[model samples]
Structure formats: structure tokens, C-alpha cells
Target: VQDNLEGALTEADIEPLNMPEMDRDELVEGESFKFTLLCQVKPDIELKGLDALTVNRELVEVGDTEINAEIEGLREQNAELEPVEDRGSETGDIVTFDFVGTLDGEEEPFDGGSGTEHPLELGSGQFIEGFEDQLIGVKEGDERVVDVTFPEDYQAEHLAAKLAHFACTVKSVRCKALADVDDEFAVDLGHDDLSALRASVYDRLFEAATKEKDGDVREQLLKGLMEANEIEIPAALIEMAQKQLQNQMGMHLAMNGMPRDQIAQAMESETEGVLERAKEMAHRDLLLDAAAVEGDISVSDDELEERIGEIAVDMNQPKAKVRASLQENDRIHSVRGEMLHEKTLRWLEEQASSVSGDSTSASAEGNPTADDASDSNVEVADEES
Candidate 1:
């Protein structure tokens, strides 16, 4: 039924609310047949999508401070840990310890409050505030009681704002022996010299800044599109969209090693704003399609292939294999649709104006993009449900 609906109405974004009113058995080949479907469709409205949008683009300025920071990070990465024998432990020293955290007056440690052979850097804030402070002067093989209070809004509700005592055994202490920075340092990092490394770092940072600016523009344009257009979506469509969202989330979590039962339990416990998110996703897709039509944006075959080629490169796969996978999953059209959506955004970015102050473009109501949004007749077999 979905395939047929998409085949007949490519950009209609219609969701059928009921079975079609026509009997499939009664239809004859090569003859005109009409069926009625109670469809709740996307409304066509003028979008302020590609207009005098005001966005901000920060100047990509890379100073010596930033370059030196990057170089320091590289130095830290190349540094080795040297065992500390003279001093106990300092703010920047790495301490290996075993700890069992117990709430005040409790005998046994609370769940998830104990660890053995934990390596932590003092002042790194890996542990609670006072916990690290108390570990500051601890030497190897030392035993001490560290006291700290969890934050009021701690993630574990049971432990929030509770004063806990950690029985700690200091195992070892180490400090970073930072690598020397010189002409040889640049060669070690695959650069000709320190100057070349600085230049490369600046170029990388500038490119990242450019992408971030483009992202901001796209976000602002989408905001303008949503604000300038008001489309009434039906409840059935929202329900369908919510299911798709849940499935997508489930797939993502499963891919990340989350147990299916746990995922279901988590989702069940946190469904408050899922409907709103689904509605927003649906609304965004509809508005993007309308913007594409307004911009006359079309994705050519070669363009789609080239985009896939880029994806192939990024994923380290053959272009043909990627194309085949997308085809097998019937996501090729979705890729094209995304391309159209991106093209529309790029066009809007081109038309946007950058200013120092925060400004938003306004749009006026105009003619609908298609025929008046009405309940179109559609036909489906009862068994199809």
C-alpha cells in the first residue's frame, strides 16, 4: 500500500487513515478503475526558505595561542608516564588506586560506588570534588579515607547530595615526561618543519570553522522555513512517524550493543517527548520537500552517483558496493531526496545575508505549492492491512 501510494504521489507525503473503498477483485486490466482512500496529506505552503535570511559567520582567526595549544596536545600525546618515587602525588599526577565508596554510616559500599586499580589524574575532576583533593598527598601503599558529597543533581538519584566515604589504597603514582618541541618534533608528526605544522593546523581549523558556519546557516534557514509556514498534520501521520522513529532509535541502540529488552524498557520509561520529536521530523521533511519544489531542485543521476562516490570514499567501500547496498535497502531515493534538501539549503545560504546583529527574515503567506490539501480517495484491499 505504501509503495503504491508513493508511486502515485511522490511528494504528497500522504498517510492513509483507512482501507480503500474499492474491491481489488472487481478491477479489470487495461480498464479505468477508481478507488477511494481517506488520506491525510502534507499541506503545501510558501516557505521563507531561500530568502533574505540573516546569519552569522565568525572570522576564522588562528593565533599563536591556538597553534601552540595544538602543539602542546601533540606533545602530551607523545609523552610517556614516568613512575613517581620522590613525591607522593600532586594535582597533575596520575594515581592508581583501589576505592570502595560507602555512604556515611553504611557498612557496605553502595552499588556502582567501588572500583579497584582505578587510574585517575588529580584535578581532572574524574571523581567527586573533594575526593581528588583528599588524594592529593597520598603516597604509594598508603591507606586513607576520602570524603566527598555528590552534586545535588547527580545522575544516580540514590547518591545525589549524599556524603560518601571512600576507603582508598594508593597503588602507584606517575607523572608525564613531556616530549621536547623542536624542528625534530615536526618531522616526527609527519611535517617538514614546525612552520609547516602550524600552517597545516591553521588550515584545518579554518576549514572546520567554515563547516561550522555553514551548519549554523542551514539551521537558521530551517528555523525560518518552519516559522514562515504553518501546515496542519494529521494524528495518524504523527503516529506512523512515531513508530518509524522508535524503530530507528532501536536499531541505533542495538548497533551500539544495547540489549533489546533494555532498550525497550528505557524507551518505555522515557516516552514523554517522543511524539513532539516525531512531529518535528515529519514537519521538517514536508517543509524541505516544499522548499525543494520552490527552488526547482533536482538531483541528477551523475550527481547522486558522485555523492555516493564521496560516501564510498569516506566509508572505505567501493562505489558500486555502496550503490548496491542502498538499492537493496530501497534507500537510493532517500539519498536523492537528501541531496535535493541539501541543495535547497545551499541555495538559501547563497541568498542569505551575514550581519553583526541577530536578525531573522520574515516571510509572507502566498499561494500553495500544489492542489488544495484535501482528503484524496485511495483504494486498498482489506487484507493489506
Candidate 2:
């Protein structure tokens, strides 16, 4: 009957919801249902030959300045936090203290806090605004009471704008980091010496930087394609993206030990913004798929398997387990979409002419835009709401 035809819908070029024929039936009790109906047909894109497409592969050059920065970063990561026998704790030094935080006349400590060896770095601004600054002059074995008011929009409702007193007893003081950036340091890092270490580090840095620059070019190319191309995306896909985004975010928060109540609150606060982001991203994806078809670029089965293996390696999981997880979650289509996007980006690079000489490089140290100041507020809203 109509049910059998509906079951075969996926086998056809069109989806079950987009089938051309409409069928209906009425039961004995007079209850009736529309059995099958195809709303519309999907548009097709004409393909071009690979010989007609010309994509330029970019060459990224890294110099001494970039090498030095890379080496410094690696040294920092491998840097040891050693104790200073003579020097006193400074702005960046770690300060171990036993503290009792109290509100009003009550001497009770904050929940999960009190008489503990809490590590605080002066001027880190990790605690309340004035909390760490007040301990600037205090040395080891010193006892003091710090009085401060929490921000008006603090995360904890009870602590918001509340005047509080923290009775702090400094247990020990640790001083300046004496990092060894010498040939001996390189030997300790499993290298022969400083020169060999620098060379190796430089090579790795150039590879990483070149790859990153290429990724940026690819992103710009894909974004341009998405902007130029126009297509109506299925509403089902948008809804799915929204729900998937929510679920993924929930899983991320759960992995970070966030409670259910906190996750629910975060979702309620972020739903609208998340949906908007998802909608834009989904539209971009649909346009890219169309572009992939138009360019006749595709990923093979081997390419897909290679991609899956790479993702599994990045996640520190076995390939079999990752494959099983993807199958169980029915995310094979998501993987195909990812491959299609990559192919589409390659196609865009082929179509467009790019002039790449040299542009002024922005420092990675500072904030990217003025809008980041507003983003800080949004982040607070996300955390507290």
C-alpha cells in the first residue's frame, strides 16, 4: 500500500517528504490521514571537469622572528615552577594562604572554602576585583583581613554586591621564575644542544604557521563562495542543526562537570544566539554543498576513512571505537558534509584569482577587535545566567 511506497522513499532520488505522489486513506472509525506527499524537487547543479579548474597552492615563509617566538612558547610550556629560597613573592609569584571568608558578623567560611592552602597569584585578577591586590605588601607568615564587595552581577546570587571580609594567613611565599633558555636547557629538552633545538623548533613552527595560514585562506574562499551562492536550505536541516548544537553544548558542559541546573540555565540564556549562529552556519554549508556539485569535486571512500582516522587520532581514541560511535549516532552524513565543504573550498580557490604578496600581520597577543569588550559582558551573562 501507500506505507510500502513511503518506506521506499529514501531509495528514490527525492526524500520521503519530497515525493511527487500523494496518497490518503480512511479507517473504519472515519479517522483519515494523508499517507504520502512530495512537496518539491531539489535543484541540481551542473558539474565541470577537473582540467578546467585551477587552484593555487600557497607557499608560507617563516623567518627568524617567528622561530624565536615559537621557541619561547615551547620553553614556557616546559618551564618548571620551582621554589625560591631567598626572594619574596612578587606580582606573578604563587602565594599559598589559609583563609576564612565571612559575610556580615558571621565568621563562617564560604562553601567549599575555609582554612585551606589556597594558591593565589598577585595581580592575576582571578578573585574579586580588590582581593589579590590587597595582599601586595604582605609577606610570608603575615595575617590580615581583606574587606571587599562582590560585583553587582556576581554568579552566586547570595554573594552579589555583598560586603565580605576574608581573614587571610599567608603560609608561604614563592618568587620569580628563573627559566633556563640556554644550551643546557635544550639538552634537558631531549635535544643535542641549543642550535639543533632552535633548528628543529623552527622547522615545526614553519610547518604549523604555513598550515594555519592555508586554513585561513581556505576559510575566506569558502565564506566568499557561501556569500555569492544563493539556495533555499531545508527547514528540517536548520532545526536539526539547532538541536544538534544544543546537545553538543550540553555534552561539553557535562564533560566539564557542570550540573544539570547550570546546563539548563546556560541553554535557556544561549538558545536564541546559538540558533542564529547555527542558521548562518547551516546556510553556508548548504551553499558549499551546491558549489561542490557544481565544481565536480568529491571525496572518495578512502579519503573519508582517512579523515575519520585523523579525527580519531586527534581525540586520542581508537579508529574502530570512533567509527562505531559515528555509526551509533547516525552522524555519517555530518562527515560527508564536512568532506563536501573541504571540496567546495578547493573549488572556490580554483575559480577566484588571489593576489598574495604580504599584508601587515596583527600581533596575536592583543584582542582582535573593539567588539571583544562587549563580548566580555556576553560571556558574563552566559556564566551567571
Candidate 3:
């Protein structure tokens, strides 16, 4: 009877508010048993003020200075390095040499203080201050003792702001030949001419800027929606979101080449910080979910299949395989939740008015902050699902 009741509730798409309470009567052999079951229904949510929200939309303009700087960056990327046998080291030259550094009153060189055949760009500021300056005018086979002081905030505690002497030897020198921004350079880059290259760069920059601005607008809309609505989020949901946040952070760290052990250590050390972010994320999620319900936004079966197909294409996996993987991992609901969230945001955006004269102009060469880029992808709380 208990099994039948549970199965029936699941089939009806009903979830108990808490574990069901059951009362049973003892029965003799071949006699019927009696039982009473009690369950609580989910609470209804009332969402308000979604249609009256206001959000600012930013209009971004890309300037010529930004385009010129982008072209210069391309030139730098394509610059050729040629051996410089006729001259000594100069600013902007790549110099190869060996060096050994020692502190005052030290008999042997310090740890990580020596190297051989190290290639460094003279004006790149890759070494300690004044170290590269002393390398200027040094020719092949020239040896000298260079003196420099480390900054007070150096990573190594013992060497911070300390004076040191480096025994350096010049091995070879090379200079870069930067390509001119002309028609010929455009041809090398697969463009018809300089004008074509410039147009392409402008288009890409404009697209990036527009995307960044859209993200800001979306965030503002979400913030407005959140401010207008107040809802109680379940503790269970918060815990799940926190775990999902940790997993995402761990994945990000691993993707950036952090070792597994180090990633574990980092997660351990950042527990409170991660939990705080998780709580905020979870709160936003609950608000979005309530709005979705109130607005009657939902993901259809066909929509889910379409989304899965797109993911398969992006991941270069077979659609059937990806579908099976999602089912096996019980993540189909997570995708559905993400789709619902997107729909809610779109609905809110339609309801809100974009404030005029709030547009800001910025350089194209400068990258957007992490907050600006955060909306490029929507991270669903898969664990919560």
C-alpha cells in the first residue's frame, strides 16, 4: 500500500511537503490490513512587479584609436625575430644569457638564482627593475656584475627589498621585424586589403561590445526583479547550490592547469567565500523560478530535444550518446531548469523599459570585467535538480 501511494504521488507529479506519516493496523494471516497516510502539498508562490520593472540598456561605440591599437597588436603577433650579430643588446632586442644572483655575505647563490641560456626581451620588463637596463650595451661573451634591489612586496619574503648582485653573461641578441599595417599584411592574414581587415576587426569589436552591454542589461533586470520579490528558499536547495558552486570552481581551476591536489586545497580554504556566493546564486535562482511559474514560462519536450542536439553539436558528440549520458546522470531536469530561467529573463526583459541616454563609450582594446562577461553562459544548479 505504501509503495502504491508513493508511486501514485510520483505519477501525479506531486511532492510531499515533508516525509509522509503513516498509521497501520496489525493484521492476522489472510486478513486485510488498514493504513492511513498523510502528506503535505507544496506551498503556492505569489510573484509581483515583474511587468513594471525598469532597466538601463547601454549603447557602446568603438573608436578609431581602439581599432588602431588592435591592428598594432596584430602586428606584434606577426613580428619576425632576426638574429642581430652586428650590434650589442638594445631596447626591444631579445637577449640570451646566463646569470647567478647572490645576496650580501652569501657564499653560494640563492635558490632559483641561476639559469643558463635564458632568453629575455630587453624592454619587456620581465626581470627585476634595473636588471635589464644593466644588460644594455652588452655584446656576445661580455660578462658583468649587475646590481638590483627587489621590491618590498616581492613574493619571496627573504628577498623583499634586498640588494643582490648577479653575475651575467651575454650569449646572443635578436631583434623583431614588425610587419607594417598595409595591403600586403592584409593578404597574409587572408583578407583582401587593409580596408577589409579593418572592417572585419571593427565588426568583431562591435559584436563583443554589444554582447557585454546586453549582459549588463540582463543583470540589472534580474536585480530589479529580485528587489521586488521576496521568497523563502529551502535550506536543502541552498546546500545543493553550494556544492554545485564548489564543483564549478574546481572544474574552472582544473581547466586552468591547477593540479587536483591544489584544487582540493583551494576549495577547502575558500569554503565560506564559496558558500556566500552560492547562497546569493541560489536566491536569484529561486526568484527566477517563481517568476517562471508566475509567467507560465516552461520548457517543452521538443525544446529539450533541440537543446540537447545543440549541445551535441557543440561538444562534437553523437546526439543519442549525449542524450543517454544526460539521462544516466539525471541532468535532464537541470537543462530544463536552465531553459526556464532563460525564458523568465527574456520575459522580464520584454516587460522592462530601457532608459535612454545611459549609453557609455569605452575603448575596444580594453577587456570587460569578469562581471561584464558573467552572462555569456548560464550555469544551472545541477546538483539542486
Better of 2 and 3 by lDDT: 3
Clashing pairs in 1: 36-378, 37-377, 37-378
Taking the tens digit of each residue's C-alpha lDDT, what string does model 1 give over 1-385? 4456556554654554544333343578898666544555556567764565667755545455555677778876877788888877998889999999899989998977899999999999877777888888788999999889899966456678999999999999888777566657668989876556666665665566557766776788777777777688666667867887888878887897766666887567557677888888777778878877877888999999999999999999999999999999998988998899888887777677876432221112211112311121111122200
Assess each prediction's global lDDT (C-alpha) against the native. 0.73, 0.67, 0.78
> By the TM-score metric, which is better: model 2 or model 3?
2
Model 3 misplacement above 4 A: 1-44, 86-172, 357-385
Instruction: Give a tens-digit lDDT track for model 2, residues 1-385.
Output: 5566656565665653233566566645765545655465444533233223323445566555565566666655665566644555668767889988888667677763365788887877888998888887677788988899989876455678988898999887765443456667668888876666666765576567667877777666655555555566666666767888998999998998776777888788898999887887767666666667676778888888998999899999999999999989987767977887877776676676656533223234222123332222111111110
Candidate 1 residue 1 Cα shift, in angstroms, is 10
Model 2 residue 316 distance off true place after TM-score fit, in angstroms: 4.8
Q: Which residues of candidate 2, in runs, are more than 4 Å off?
A: 5-8, 16-25, 28-34, 38-61, 74-88, 104-107, 112-115, 315-318, 358-385
Query: Highest lDDT among the candidates is held by which one?
Result: 3
TM-score to native of every candidate shown:
0.74, 0.75, 0.71
Q: What is the C-alpha RMSD of each candidate to the true structure, in Å?
A: 16.1, 10.0, 10.7
In model 3, the Cα lDDT at residue 33 comes to 83
